[model samples]
Target: MAFKPQSDSDGALSEINVTPLVDVMLVLVIILLVTAPLLTQSVHVTLPKTASTSANIDAQPLQLGIDALGVITLNKQPVINLLALEATLKAEFTKNKDVGVHLYADQAVVYKKVAEVMATVQQAGIAKMAFVTVEE
Candidate 1:
């Protein structure tokens, strides 16, 4: 038995026909070529250059948050007052001298309350502290 085309003629067509496949593939390639440029067009921007500062900090940072009610929290756990906040920071700093603190204050909270928290953190000897702000 020989492989043969099922057609009106009984004889086999020996040549492998790839013309239709090649035509379909070429059409796909052309479609991709037409749309690729549109997909990759982007806004050109002039970005400012700055000297990169080396960050030597390797310890996990503690988060201190003051919500709108003037309530304070140390790493999400509620602290009674600034004295408690200072105690928490002091204990954490004792474990890792380079421990950093990130402060998050709600927009409705008073600046004096935030400042009091900062002073407490400073008194705790935590030198690495930064105010966390949300971008518009």
Candidate 2:
């Protein structure tokens, strides 16, 4: 016998199956319906009211400057020597426990002078100190 071609009725299906798609959509709708109510549920709370008050701004930082010549100044006033600086710092620390120092050192000042000043500040029992520098 001679070879023969297949008939059109034996061709692959071209229509889409919608049963699984409808089932998945129904499941997702049911999940959303269930979760939507849960999402809206929240605990009712009663909070207490407090009196309004102004913020306290009492303390100011001390500005300490050291020039290239190794001369030290506190708050624009020159200090005699390291001993005097330590004494003054101790007094300031005693005056305000939260007092902080903003140190401004000259760009040409030596490292030794800066280190010595830092040591003196630490010896005076000051825990808060910051170096002030200009942005390049």
Candidate 3:
């Protein structure tokens, strides 16, 4: 009887077959391409910085205050209504592009009231806004 070469068995292969892995990776890339744009269509972009000048920049923002009675005021005078606030903001911001809005709300003011004012400010198209809060 002679030894059969076909029957001789030895596990000697040390290489990984990665064709299936490559195929799965390619599928993932295609999926990303299809969905990425759809996911970000509604996004708004913030501007990037450019080197120019910081000398004229103010250290603080123009403060818009809401007292305990839910009254709106700018700097100290009562704005009386959203229209008044918008008018004042528009006038102040007409010459300055870097003007910022800071909002202070009395703790008694509800989230709805604050959000309404924020919406009005946003509609007025102010570039930046900050919520003023007290430290404990």
Q: What is the C-alpha RMSD of each candidate to the true structure, in Å?
A: 13.1, 6.3, 11.0
How many residue pairs clash per model? Answer: 0, 0, 0
| Highest-TM-score candidate | 2
- lDDT tens digits, residue span 7-118, model 2: 7677776899999999999999999999999999999999889998885476888899999999999999999999999999999999888889999999999999999999
Whichever of 1 and 3 has more lDDT, that candidate is: 1
- CA deviation > 4 Å runs, candidate 2: 1-56
Residues 59-132 of candidate 3: C-alpha lDDT, one tens digit per residue: 45689999888999988788878888888888777767678889999999888888889988877778799988
Evaluate model 3: give its TM-score. 0.57
Candidate 3, lDDT over the whole model: 0.85
- Score candidate 1 by lDDT: 0.91
* Model 3 bad stretches (over 4 Å): 1-54, 58-60
TM-score of 1: 0.57
In candidate 2, what residue range of length 10 has the lowest lDDT sum? 3-12
Model 1 deviation from the true structure expressed as Cα RMSD, one decimal place: 13.1
Q: Which model is ahead, 2 or 3, in terms of TM-score?
A: 2
